[model samples]
Every structure is written in structure tokens, then in C-alpha cells.
Target: MNPTRSTFGLIFFTKKANENGECRIYSRITINGKSVDLSTKRIVDKILWNSAKGMARGTSKESLEVNDYLEQFRSGVVDAYQEAIIQQKPLTPENIRNAFLGQDEAAHPFQDLFNYHNEHEKQVLAKGTMKNYYTTQDYILQFLKKSKKPAEWDISQLSYKFIADFELFLRTFKKKDDPQPLNNNGVMKHLERFKKMINMAVTIEWLDKDPFVKHKLKFNSKERGYLSEEELALVETKELKTDKLMYVRDLFLFGCYTGLSYIDAINLTANNLMIGIDKEHWLITQRQKSAKPVKLPLLPVAAELITKHRHDPRAISNGTIFRPISNQKLNDYLKDLARECGIDKNFSFHLARHTFATTVTLANGVPIETVSKMLGHTKISTTQIYAKVVERKVSEDMQALRSKLSRKTVPDGEMIILK
Candidate 1:
């Protein structure tokens, strides 16, 4: 009694007849003693059906045509079952029905699944992520049109060739909004979105195999720049003329201490601040981007900034721990601040996050694992990216080793020589 052993046959519903006294035909699939019925969309009069034979009583033209159609439908169902067996797919009635109806993911159109995935994900994904998914969809549509392919593609057609061609199109094709084509990582993001939809198809058994199995997504790692301690000190000490610039600077420094992104920083409230196990002030909040919890003990500088803003009328009225500022204006003021402070680098709010990871934490003797937790990183590997930027730490480590070796009477007995 192997569960995969399936039996299928065509049957007519003689009890349920229409006004014309015709009963609808159905195909029944049985697997592991379980059964399911699928409509064949064909009908015949009760008098013409032969229950024992499981077909219409035949001889006349109409009867012969009905019998022939039934035979063909039965053959298709049997073929589907045989194919499932050959492929070693789970032999389920629903799977067989999908196969017989040509609705298995291999025969199913890609657009349908893509749309379904997008619609389902809208409830759970962040707004920015949903925008990326939409953009990826648009890119796919554009590729199909440029290649003169059909609006609908079968799930089976999502081969390595298809992925390669789509990636090439993304690299070379220019959209109306921008003249430059997508960079490597940007292209990979779209492919990743496409892969997500395909995975969903596989999860539901709509697709028998993953087309992206052999295709590996490649990304170029760009240098993530952050302000050094000296540069940060300069920015902190600089006196700016405008109140707006001062406000932006304070907010930027707050991020540098807490490693919060602009969205997370602006969304913070008094409720998010809590006493930790050490009875010290802590920012206990969830990251807006990934909704992961972040528990960071407030450093002296970060605490001072929070106290400065605690009594601000705007913050009190807005019910936010800090007064809100648009990200664009913040970045614009950071650029001006960089020039005024003599820091020669592109300055943005996100750089504050990078600075926190490198200068504020790692270089200051904090473990990367602890820094990752404070930063609300779901993976330590993400925090490792910042670890690479701690060249000062590397130098200090080597220098400390050199100092220890120099102090040691390395064996007043033996002299070492370089190769």
C-alpha cells in the first residue's frame, strides 16, 4: 500500500441532471485510498451513460463522440499520473488534477504566480520592499516586451538561459527615469525577487523543480565608508551658523552612538527607552527596516543628546523622542557640515551607522557579536562588513604583538634572520 500508487478513472454523476436531463462528467483520482473529483466540462444524458462500463452507452454519432472525448480525457489523466511517477513527485490527487488540467506549475503561466506572490507579500513586507518588488515586476515586463516574448511564460520556461538573458537585459537596458543601466548588485536584487516568487511556487507544489538551482547570483562588494574618530570629533566640535545645521548634526551624532538608521531614529519615542539589567538607560526598540528587536545600552554621548532633546517643544508635541527631519534635508546638511569640518568624504545620515559600527564600537574594543546584537542585525556576517573597516584595530593589534616580542629576551641565545 504505497501512497504513491494512484488509480484514476472517468465517471458520470447520474443523480445530478440538468434541465436537459444531462449529467456532468468527472474524472476521479485516488491516491493512498484518498479520492478527489475533477470536472471534465462535458455532459451526456443519463440514458446514454453506462454506469458499469464507466462511460456513455455508445453506437450513435453523438454517443460515439462523447465516448471518444471521455477516452481522450481518461488518457490525459493517466498520462499525468505516469509523468508524476516518472518524475517521482508526491502522488497526490490535487497534484494529478493540476497535471491533468495543464495547471501544474510547469504548464502554469509565470505572471499569475508572480502577481499572486506580490499580492500575498504586501501584507507583511515593508513599504520600501514592496516598491522594489513592483520595480522588479516592471523590469521583467520590459524584458519580455523587448525580446518579443509572450506576456505569459510557463513556469517550466524559467531556465538558466532565461535568467541569464534577463540579467543581460538589466545590465544593458535603460529605463525612462535613468539613462544608466542597473549595476551588478542592483540587477541581482531583481533576480532575487524573481527567485523568491519561484520558491513560493515550489513550496505550493505548483512547480516541480526550481529553475534557479544552477544559477548563482553574483554581487560586487563596494567599500562602505565611515568617519574616523578624528573626523567625528571635528564634526562634533564644529560650530555651525544655522539652527537647522546644528539640529541635523546632533541627530547624526545620535545615530553614530546608537547605530540607528534615519527611519529608526525618527520613529523612536519615550516608550522605547527602558531600564536594562544593569539599571542603565537603554534604547529597546525594533528596527523599522527588518522589524528586528534592538537592545542597546545608551552611551554617555548618546544619553546627553537624548536629554538635550527631551524637553524640546517640538518633540513633546510630536510625541517623538527626537524632532523629525526629512532624510533628504539631513543628507544635504551633512554635506555642508563635512565641508565646514574639513572631512573630505561624501557625508550622509547612513554614514553615522557605519561610523558607529567601526569607530564607536569595534575600534573601541567591543566584540563584533555584541555590536551586531546592538545594531539589530539578524546575521553577524552583516556586522562583519563593518569589522573590515577597522584598519586602526589591525594596526594596533600588530603593534601590540611587536611591542611584546621586542620586550621578550627572545632567547639571548639565538638571533633571527628574515628570509
Candidate 2:
């Protein structure tokens, strides 16, 4: 620690064993009593250190001010030493929440979010989710820097208008590398990430309330156009004829018939297919999006495709039904299939799942609830989005009901019109 510095240290002791090792090491740093790092200390100390140096070089009545600067420097040194003596590990969410319970009501929500995310990234969230959290934090920090505000400013000062304006900023904002503005969905996603971070803050008792409570997240409904039966047949014909691209197309189309997502489909193997309880039907027991195992009856078309690929070399070695292919590459191949099929709309891996829902199941009079279960949707509402595609079937159902309800001159006039 330097007497001219404006920083403190944060050290924690952890037990370690070696041939001749039992000593404490300075693990981290802080300012006052809050967490900081060595880089942050250098940043905070540079100006004050320069000012003290300038005062020391002066030649006037303010010569004694050098002593004052020296005392300030001494205070910083003492704080750093005391901090090291009392330092512990990086603060956890529970530690932060308990701290909040006793502190004055002026702490910044953003700091709370940062602290909570730090702990959660190491302990709870999946690796992919943690990476996204860091991305969201970066976006927010960049926006705040552009606004010329302190990084640790009070979040209570934030308003719904501020959040809305930040979203607008993201849309109109452009980097030198990308001159085009961010799209609506992109901006909404970043803002929603911020909201989720805030929600986490509230969950950890870091904030009294969530500032985003008043804001509604708006996202455009995506139009997922699956292939028609005719289009699917055309693809199948072209795929079965092609050698280089046949396997990819087959696996993708198999997914189309079975309503399997690309990830779940790729991970499926012979082991997943087994005899049902009745032993009359084969079943595919697989985990879908929510990690819930669902048992779907093996349809003939799906079964045939599986049988065809049963002898593939990769399947033999890896014991998985399909060779591993990246989702991006799989989607790229689907674009080729769409081009060959003369279909105009863009298609992707997920379209296979949508195709099974709209074309194979709902179009053939299967109940939406049954389709929802086969699709492994945790909620029926998620599957109901396909109802738009099943409008014709619903119309036919309504017409049939109307005809069945139409009475032919009942015994009493007006068919006794039940109350």
C-alpha cells in the first residue's frame, strides 16, 4: 500500500497445506469497505496521487498543503491495511442481502445486480446463461458510459422513461463496425435482459422493488411457416435421391414427422426407443426442451426413417441415431432443401417441429392438447400458437357441430330449446 494512493485492500484467508506453507495472501482489494480490484484502485488513485505530487513541488504559503495531502495519503494506506486484516471471500447473495437489511436505503440496484450475478454465475446459472448475463452487463455498462453517469449511481433514480429511452438508444445506436441500427427484437432482447437482471436483484433482496414492474415487454409474434404436405414430399424425393446431403435431410425430416427439436433429435439414440408397457407399440422416450422425458409412440414414418439410418457408421460408433451436425449447418442444409422444393419461405431446423404440429397432427384432426403433450410443451398455451395454422380444421369442426345440432322438426315446436 502507498501512502499517496486512494485505495484500500480486501484480503481473505483460506486454509492451504504444503510442505512448509501456512500464510495469508492478499487476495483482493476494496475502496472504503466496498469491493474493488487492483485495477480499479489504480484508476481511483491516479488523480489524487498526481495532485499530491504537484502540491509537493509547489513553493508558496500552501507548502503545508503537502502535509495535508500526505495525511490523506496516510489515511488511504491505513484503510487499505485495515481492509486486508478484515477481508473475506467475495460477497455472496445472502451476504449482500443481509448487508442490505442493515444499510441505509441509498444503495444502487445495479451494484446489487452485479454482485448477485457474480455469485450466481459461479454457483447456479448454466454456463450459456452466465455468458449471456455478462453480455447484458456489457451492453448496460456501455450505455451508462455513453450517458456520462457514474457506474455506481443509485438505481432508485431510474424511471420507466429511462428504461424506454435506453431501448430507443439501442435501436438508433450503431457501432463503427456495424453502421446499421439494432432491430426492434434485438433492442427488446437487451432490455428484457436488463429487466431479468433487475428481477434477480429483487429476488435476492437487493432492491425493495423492481423498476421494470411498470414496463411491459413487447415482442412481435414470429410467423413459423412449416412445409406443406406436398412440399415435404418433394423434399423427401430430392433427399432420397441425393447422396452427399441425404443423411442430414433424412434426420431433419424424421424430426419433422416426430415433432422433435433439432437438439433433442440429434441426441436421440437407439436406446431411447424401447418397448411400451403393453408391448404392442414401440415408444421413443426422450427429453424435450424443459428436460422432461416424454414417451411418444413411434409412428410408422418415423420408425422407417430410424430403421434406414440404423446401419450408418456414425450411429454405430456413437450409438446415436443421427450424426452430430451443428444447428447452423443443419439450417443451412434446410435452406437448400427449401430451394430445391421451390418453396419461397425461409425454413430452419425448428420448422420441422412446427411442420409436425401444423401439417401432420392438427391438420389430420389430432387434438391440440395431444399435440402439446407430444411436443413436450410445459404449458398448452405455448402449443396454441399453432392454432392459427389449424383455422381450416377448426372451421370444419364448427360446421360439423352446427350440422349435428341442427334439429329436424322436434316433437314439440322449436325443438323444446333446452334452457
Q: After aligning candidate 2 to the native by TM-score, how far in Å is the CA of 402 from where it should be? A: 7.2
> Per-residue lDDT for 331 in model 2?
85
Q: For residues 48-153, what per-residue lDDT tens digits would candidate 2 score against the true structure?
A: 2233233223444344454454445445545435443356423322233223233364366566667767786557554445666777777777878888878986
lDDT by candidate, in order shown: 0.83, 0.65
> What TM-score does model 2 achieve against the real structure?
0.64
Q: What is the lDDT of residue 383 in candidate 1?
A: 90
- The per-residue C-alpha lDDT of model 1 at residue 98 equals 76
Looking at model 2, report the run of 10 residues with the lowest lDDT sum. Answer: 37-46
Residue 211 displacement (Å), model 2: 0.4
Off by over 4 Å in 1: 1-74, 77-99, 102-111, 409-419
> What does candidate 1's lDDT look like per residue over 1-419, in tens digits?
24344455445444478888989776666776656656667888888988787787869887899889888988888898888888888777667777877664335676788778878998888776888888898888888888888887666545679889998998999867989988899999999999998899876656545779999989888888898888899899998999888988999999999999998898889999999999999999999778899999999999999999978999999899888787878899999988888889999988999999999999989988999999899999999875454789989999899767966956665666779
Please list all clashing residue pairs in model 2, or write none if there are none. none
